[model samples]
Target: MSEINKVKVFRVQGTGPTPVTVKISRIGKALRIKCDCPAGAYMDPCEHWKSLFTGEDQNYLDITDDEIREIQDWLDDSDLDEALQNLLYFEGHEKNMHENLARQKRALRGRVIDILISDPQL
Candidate 1:
């Protein structure tokens, strides 16, 4: 069996009364992530998207362990995986240098946003 295409859908609890949906899918060699939040509507990778990768979205996520593994696998196969690792590495080593860390975050954030907007499903 082959995992040719992968998809994960999450209904995350947000500020609104109802939860919003964040859809992540693998398209060829690119990733397509979509969220129904304001930031996502503008093609921004909102906290919803980031938290999913960071595992900080557990409280808001209504998914099973198997689904979690699937998402992790999807991320592991994407370029964002390397970017996230770099971001984490910098975060740990640049704590004392707040100014430098801020700059690094901005630069890395731009790359992540660019990746998010690269292959919009719409």
Candidate 2:
């Protein structure tokens, strides 16, 4: 069978005393990215994974630049790429989505959580 199921865990700096776990899983067609921090465990996307995917390296205080670049490159090649791109696009152009703002936000959150809670190939 074609290889598609995969998971990558990153020890991200910031958000707490120790590094946090940021997991990116590709199960079937969904890309479920999760963070173990308080906010993330509740299905909210914390700045830990958000900053990593959003390329906000300067916001980091503990990780090295090389580590940041590695995560960036890895995410760029992973299934999360499309999701990240979609998120970036949505954030940048959502002003045009005027009336659909709340609905879109809810849809994105539910879709992401649903993907994460589903059975995993791993």
Candidate 3:
């Protein structure tokens, strides 16, 4: 018998607080990578896994399971109303933010707007 299941988590250092979780499972003689970030949302291998496997200088911070779980739990329980309010309050501040970060924030704001408009419970 060989190691068949493993999990690793890392904090991607960037404009936003991004934590990526990687799960590797073995079946027969092959290993697979699974991640839960936007780049991996489609259930395919993502850049995070690629960087780890390739030993590239991705400049990410290694994190423990507890830290990742704390972030994940917060995301899971996030309140849409509060999130929208915060985004609206800081809407124009993106002018002073980094270009890539501002773009990500804008994209997230747009998605939240769409969700709010379409959600029947709201």
Best by lDDT: 1
lDDT of 1 by residue, 15-114 (tens): 8888889888885556678999899989876767677666664345677777767777777767567876686666657775888888999999999888
Q: After superposition, how far is residue 24 of candidate 1 from its true place, in Å?
A: 0.5
TM-score: which candidate is best? 1
lDDT of 1: 0.75
lDDT of 3 by residue, 22-47 (tens): 65443333444567777678865455
Each model's TM-score? 0.61, 0.50, 0.37
In angstroms, how far off is 96's CA in candidate 3?
34
Off by over 4 Å in 1: 1-3, 84-122
The window of 10 residues in a row where model 3 has the poorest summed lDDT is 72-81
**Candidate 1 similarity to native, TM-score:** 0.61
User: How big is the RMSD of model 1?
Assistant: 16.1
lDDT of 3: 0.54
In order of TM-score, best first, we have: 1, 2, 3
Clashes of each: 0, 0, 0
Across 1-122, the per-residue lDDT of candidate 2 in tens digits comes to: 67456666767667468777777666665567787888887988677777766666534545567766655665645666786788778875875777578889988999888888894952
